[model samples]
Target: MNWRKRFRTFWNRYASQVLRKILPRLESMAARLSSTDDTQELSEILATYKMSGFPLPMSFTDVDTVIENALSTGVHLTEAKNAEFALAVHIHPYPSNVLAVWVYVAVLSRKS
Candidate 1:
């Protein structure tokens, strides 16, 4: 397998475990922060995750710094209630930049 394939496999497993650990907390946070655009608080939550040892790929930068850079470079977060979290990185910036972005949107509705 090539290096890219190996990295992708590793990331898939790692990200799955991370989500299983953090999804509930994230759901609650999303609910509370839904009324306001509070990226700082959200980033703080992510920072805690990173600080806990699950540092994001690409060096050891904190989550907030990554977010700040993404915002500066043009990233968007939809206002829909289902919009949970998003991760984006710029891979190539020549002629037209290539972005690797992933957004996890989940809908929670209680049947009454």
Candidate 2:
């Protein structure tokens, strides 16, 4: 595996143990500091939150296998005409871009 995957695997194995040992001490120290001072604590919290401005990119950049398995391995026509007929029959009955279409698919797919 590449360095990124290796790093992730290493982190998954040890990061939790490290955090578990350190988090309580950090919380106790924070509590002690805030109890002694209020305004300074609030400002520090706001500053930290601001400094931690969320990381960008919603998902991973490189994707190798987009799909692990198909919905079925059975017989079915795979063409634009087949899709056109299927959509015209089932989807037209439902509101476009709505949850009803998803619900219909989920329900219909499990019928067999």
Candidate 3:
């Protein structure tokens, strides 16, 4: 299966809330920032990220892929490449569920 679809499936299983709203907001925001200046976009993502609950069924590497995919503006995953790893946060909701979430912000550049 394609990575995008895999990401959606991963979200369905692990994401704390539905991404239908926030994702587009992020995409629009990312789209607005110049690809060369993904630092701004990465900062926005790190500053705004607030996911809670759900354990990761995947790895940090998988998460890096998700961040890269979700924020990508290209027509396909192959059409974009991560230019930088700005930040990565691993959240473990304490006490009960022990949910592990890997949150990250990345800079993506259009493929040449």
Candidate 4:
């Protein structure tokens, strides 16, 4: 096969494997976050995001940062109830830039 064909084959195989491994993990994590109370769930989600390689922004330490990042990045978030949030982000590379797509759904936590 030519180099282009070889590259394509390699990329497809790699992407498929990576997605298969990561998707289930992501789903499980999201489910866990979605099922709990607002504070606990948000904490877990932030921790997961940090552990998953997206470091928290140094300038802000509130849930707003998470929401903003999710929106700015083009993640696709679903419906949210009171004091809850959920979103998915996809990152892609371009020739001269990186694109982050975020979709966000969120509900503010009840203040004490």
Candidate 5:
């Protein structure tokens, strides 16, 4: 039995379903920011804005670097703290290349 193949198929299917659910929200957010004439300002806002209702992965890190890179006309992830959970965003410029930004939101857990 090809377990790897099966796992790949399952992962792809799950990822597609998640993307279908999330793409609309992302598009809406993009549209809202599209009115801005300044790309730098847009990038800054997107990097700093706190996202809500997104099921972020628990293996996220490197958020500050991402924000800095995004602000400096590039793509990267930033570490907001020293843990998992991050906000990832990509900036694509027409007639230019695409820049990605990732913001890692550290998980603050309280042990019982």
Candidate 6:
């Protein structure tokens, strides 16, 4: 299998476990930042993830890649990329799941 498939398989199995550890830290960091510069802190978070052996995907390393991935997902994003971490809101167009809010956010990493 390709790296993407492998990564997806691994992610499907371990994402919850990893996210349980990651999300809280990120939330706290963001909350603490308030209004100051966030670049350094965000980079530090990514580095900490790397050091923890659960490094994030480097595919959306740039704005172009972020845009490309968003476009390729088949779901239309409500907003465009504007920062290192962009949340592509995917509200289902179908009537059945109209209320479903599926967020697809990619953290822009400096790796690769």
**TM-scores of the models, in the order given:** 0.21, 0.20, 0.24, 0.21, 0.23, 0.23
How well does model 6 score by local distance difference test? 0.36
- Per-residue accuracy of model 2 over 10-30 as CA lDDT, tens digit each: 122122232233333333443
Clashing pairs in 2: none
Q: For candidate 1, lDDT tens digit of each residue in 1-112?
A: 1312222211223334444445434434444643433345435445433311221223223556555544443213223332223332322122344322222222121122
lDDT of 5 by residue, 3-106 (tens): 12312211223223333444334444555753423334324334534322232222123555544433343111223332122233333333334332222222
lDDT of 5 at 31: 52
Model 4, range 4-79, lDDT digits (tens) per residue? 2212211223222333334334444454633423344335444433212222222233456655664554222222
Candidate number with greatest TM-score? 3
Query: Residue 46 in candidate 1 has what lDDT?
Result: 53
**Backbone clash pairs in model 3 (N, Cα, C under 3 Å; residues 3+ apart or in different chains), count:** 0
lDDT for each candidate structure: 0.33, 0.22, 0.35, 0.33, 0.32, 0.36
RMSD of 4: 18.4
How close is each model in CA RMSD to the real structure? 15.6, 23.5, 14.4, 18.4, 13.6, 12.8
| lDDT of candidate 3 over 1-94, digit per residue (tens) | 4635522221221222322223334333444642333434334434544322211222333455755644553333332223222223444343
Q: Candidate 2, after superposition: displacement of residue 104 in Å?
A: 40
After TM-score superposition, the amount by which residue 88's alpha carbon in candidate 5 deviates from its true location, in angstroms, is 3.8
Local distance difference test, candidate 2: 0.22
Clashing pairs in model 6, backbone N/Cα/C closer than 3 A: none
Show model 2 residue runs off by greater than 4 Å: 1-11, 33-112
Q: Write the number of the candidate with greater lDDT, choosing between 4 and 6.
A: 6
